[model samples]
Target: MGIFIRILGAFVLLSATYNPTRWNFTRWAEANWGTQMPLTLLFGLLLGVGYLIYIGATLRSIGAFGIVLVAAIVGALVWVLIDYQILTLQNPSVNLWLGIIAL
Candidate 1:
């Protein structure tokens, strides 16, 4: 229950500043001289790694009964810190709110 709230809040907060251009990271390939194919593959690989990190973090939070709320809290904080550079009042407002709720 609490984990759901934290995730929802994080998504709502992070999506506000999210830029799709970040996803189009393969533009670097065009400048590299015929490396477009490999660049696209690399982009895909990076996205996969991000997803794997997310999954691993979530899985680690699970305990004998269910998801540990504090684990989710820590994971969310680490995620926002690493992924979006969001740690202060400038970003992740909803995450801050979620943290309050979790507490």
Candidate 2:
């Protein structure tokens, strides 16, 4: 449940900020700032920091490397299930690899 909350928080942050097909907080930032790069970097930093904090707080039992490994496994599994079964994407291998690395 803790891990799920962390992941869900990250996902909500991401979708709120920069979902490709959505009007989001990032768009508002870009519109006001007249630039996208700095906002992008800021949000990315926030996301990374938030994830680290969550992991440290809730995943200490697993340690750093174990947390990363578990995240990679979960990311890969989700990618496979969604891309293959739900989306039926034509080429999901790249997404699977990227998801593992990202998580």
Q: Best-fitting candidate, measured by TM-score?
A: 2
Show pairs that collide, candidate 1: none
- In model 1, what lDDT does residue 61 have? 69
Lowest summed lDDT window (length 10), candidate 1: 15-24
lDDT digits (tens) for residues 53-73 of candidate 2? 866765667777887787788
In model 2, what is the error at residue 57, expressed in angstroms? 2.7
- Candidate 1 similarity to native, TM-score: 0.31
Give the lDDT of residue 51 in candidate 1.
56
lDDT of 2 at 96: 42
Give stretches of model 1 more than 4 Å off: 1-35, 63-103
TM-score of predicted model 2? 0.43
Candidate 2 root-mean-square deviation in Å: 6.0
